[model samples]
Target: MSMPGLSTGTIAARLNRMPITRLHFRMIVALSLIFLFELGDLNTFSYATPGLIKYWNLSVSSVGVIVSASFFGMFLGAWLGGWFSDLVGRRKALIWSTAFYSIMSLVNAFTTDTTELATVRFLTGIGMQAMSVTGLTYISEMFPKDVRGRYLPESPRWLEIKGRSQEAEKILNDLETEVETYLGRSLPEMRDFEPVQQSAKVPVAELFSKELRKRTIVLSLAWIFVILGFYGFSAWVPTLLVQHGYSVVKSLNYSFIISLGAVPGALLAWPITDRFGRKQSLFVIMFIVAFCVIMYGLAFNETTVIIFGFLTAMLLQTQTALLYSYSPEIFPTRIRSVGTGFTGGLGRLGNVAGGLLVAAIFNAFGYAAVFIYVAAAFLMGGFLIGIFGERTAKRALETISK
Candidate 1:
């Protein structure tokens, strides 16, 4: 149902030139809420572990098993969600995934034993990851190239690719009208641009096609290392502190205090990502975070631990936010979700491994060894992306992918 003269190129050009409007802000607010709940849910299990151990008498190894279960579920969810989104549209996929996780989280409260808890957690992980991958894909498609990090209706770009150009045109027309009404000025005319030809259907295996193979491998490895470091550190900090002889309440309180840095950390990326470019920003942040992780491990007292932990939390989130923006930009629209999901899913696998590594290392080699492993993970992740990732700031998605 494409309208004659309404090519994908025209849609892209119009979207690129559209001014930021209240509607865009509204969309950002809505999406931010989604991420807020998603992240809060992601850490709930980590926070609950101290209580589970005290009340249920769960062993540290048992806690690690539960953690791995959740990550395994996330691995499946990320891959499946991405594939489903491309097939059914981003809106539907997001809605389904969000609802799935929310219900599973509630179900989690009723579990009375380790087995039940692990099962529910695994299910919740799937939904959480699916929602995350879909939401990121939706953002990449709906926002303008120049300011995407800063802002969806159903993406006009996605619609056009799906051969629903008439609907895409209507959405663009509405957006333009809203922007013009808000500004009380006519927007500048769009420059001529070549249309990107749409593929009818893209198979998941296309991510490994000769044109994309290197990107897929490099990004997948980078994601694996980064996520391994992230989950290894964040998931274990509170539990480890308790094991180190701090009271459970003190560990949770300190973890919360350290977490206060997450918001500012994510916000700091907003300007720098556009200024320094995604690859460069990610590169610098990852290395800094690696050093912070080691320092956090070496701290001899509670104060130093909190300080280094706060710094680590902040920078870790900064890189995370940047990666969410960068990952979707790496693929063409036809397979953007699939590629993102695949890499992100592999990263979840890394988390699974991290959970086990944390347990094994903490038990076998003691405290400092665990941090060394986590630090090494971050360093590897940083080097991979610094050396191999594409520059994506201020560039059109189509241009970057090409």
Candidate 2:
């Protein structure tokens, strides 16, 4: 179980070696902060929309446009970001992406019409996902394959033809170069057979053989639940708080409180996931989140509102922390990004639903119903994770992929 060459500094140096470090915790902190700011800033659009409606004479459809702009950009960004980050170093891609969103957020403040908002939001989304996903891949490489951390949630590139755009090919090339130079293996030595697809699923069954399929499915389900919890909470909580009779100020304050709590969850999740185990950590988080989300909806006092508001983040956001780390752990480096990207990007379907569906539930069924729905999603996530998820704490990364 014990290897002779692993050292803390070695890991740290690997993680922070400009493009990729072995265990660059500081870079993770830096990346997390940039992401938190972007998420916080992006959510502001929801609050900003009404004011924009009056000022710009925007239509109801325009509201939909503003919200969806970010998503459309994000899906594309996931592919491009992974390609870009893999092609360039994670650091430069991140620096540029952070600056892109920072500029776009300010531009969003000045939008005079729906088109402008959509344009700005789309660009902002590009920047946001590009930075976030690249950071995810970057962080994953730095840590030991067996180690994982709280993803505090999130995807890559392909289908384009340019040298810079061809990430999958580039990655294959990188693997070839790294192997030939370091280990004296040719490209043929590292090539894997393409597994047959069964519908839209990963055909993880074929890729790794039947024995591993059960564990792979469990890992996939864990990702789905984590995302569902994150989206379900973020989407419904504000309206639910309003339905519970809180003032606009109270609702806004509480939303900010929960988001702020996510900051610490993001910072610590990676270390916790790596040290403890992804399944065990997520199990703990899901219960805390389920309990708090229930209390946030049902409790009426000001103090209880604030306490549970912060408490809500204990796990809902922690879903993100674990997801980023765990998903990649389940695949090989060649297909790791593809595997993780598939889940993270497809999961955006849930995110899009989160923005619209929960609003409908509140509009039609009331806050209590929404609370019940969110609670069910979280509890189900906990149950699914406990039952289906794999333990990636100290296992090798290549093993997960196989």
Candidate 3:
């Protein structure tokens, strides 16, 4: 049965019917559902990893490599999903990715060994960013120009500008400064930010052209480690909790507590990120997450465990708010979803890598070692944000993608 999909004109016409901001409301449902689904989807793997390993007698390296397989699918899907979404529209991608992953998730339950499991996960990853990229762009489309044109008045632009008060100019300056600052520190200053510059008028074909190889590199670096870190720790949380001498019920309970934290955290991320800027907001959250991860590892008392666990959830959930809010808003309307899918898809590579990384360290080093590794991942995320991420508060897309 097909439900009527609204045209942009139709949607725009009915804007008054929406009780909340359509963009926010769409993201609230779409991103939140995807987050919850992926959490459960990844957790299903974690819960089943041990069983699969024992049943199949798979080696750690084998599982690690197998785990990464899903990323291959996600990589293709993410980079391409945006294009597809732009070509068709935002809504289709969401419905398709969600439907695809939902079905693939069930398929995972029937897996035999690393091969079959990876295959299923791979298919699952193909749908990984369906909701993410499209949902992001939809938000950008829904908001008022006032929301788009102005940087939060008090928001720190990535670079300091003197005397520029025009909100759009301020935003452009912020984007430029953030790009320059990141390139100044991390990248060789060999090439200036042509992509960032051209974003103002660069066409999608031009943005994705051979001339802009550097842009692709910058984008890849943006999402990889941070994503890997977040997913790696999360994928193993249920397993780690179980290994902490907690029963399955307790382990599930702990994970539930963590997920619940993300709900409020997600809400917090939108306004704060909208006001402060993405890079700053992310760095702040990552720092606190690092601390929470360490606390989660050492805490033994029930109260301490639950408390730290909730903190971890808060940090993780904030992604739903910031990542989704930020991703699509950074690209052109034509290619917004594509850029989002690509980056998000690239992030899933980290998820695949994290799964394997945790799997490798789990038996060899111990849960504590695994978590420390996770903490290191978060630390890298913080470092990367401090170095590369621009403050994106009050900034809109249309030019950021190029």
Per-model C-alpha lDDT, please? 0.86, 0.57, 0.59
- lDDT comparing candidate 2 with the true structure: 0.57
Rank list by lDDT: 1, 3, 2
Per-residue lDDT, model 2, residue 330, is 64
Q: Which candidate number has the best TM-score?
A: 1
Off by over 4 Å in 3: 1-40, 43-66, 110-114, 145-219, 243-249, 300-302, 399-402
Candidate 3, residue 377: the lDDT equals 74
User: How many Å off is the CA of 199 in candidate 2?
Assistant: 25
Model 3 backbone overlap count:
4
lDDT of 1 at 126: 95
Report the lDDT of model 3 for residue 2.
22
lDDT by residue (256-276, candidate 3, tens digit) is: 777678668766775676577
The residue ranges of model 2 lying beyond 4 angstroms of the native Cα positions read 1-26, 46-65, 83-103, 145-225, 239-245, 267-271
TM-score for each of the candidates: 0.97, 0.69, 0.70
Give me the displacement of residue 260 in model 3, in angstroms.
2.7
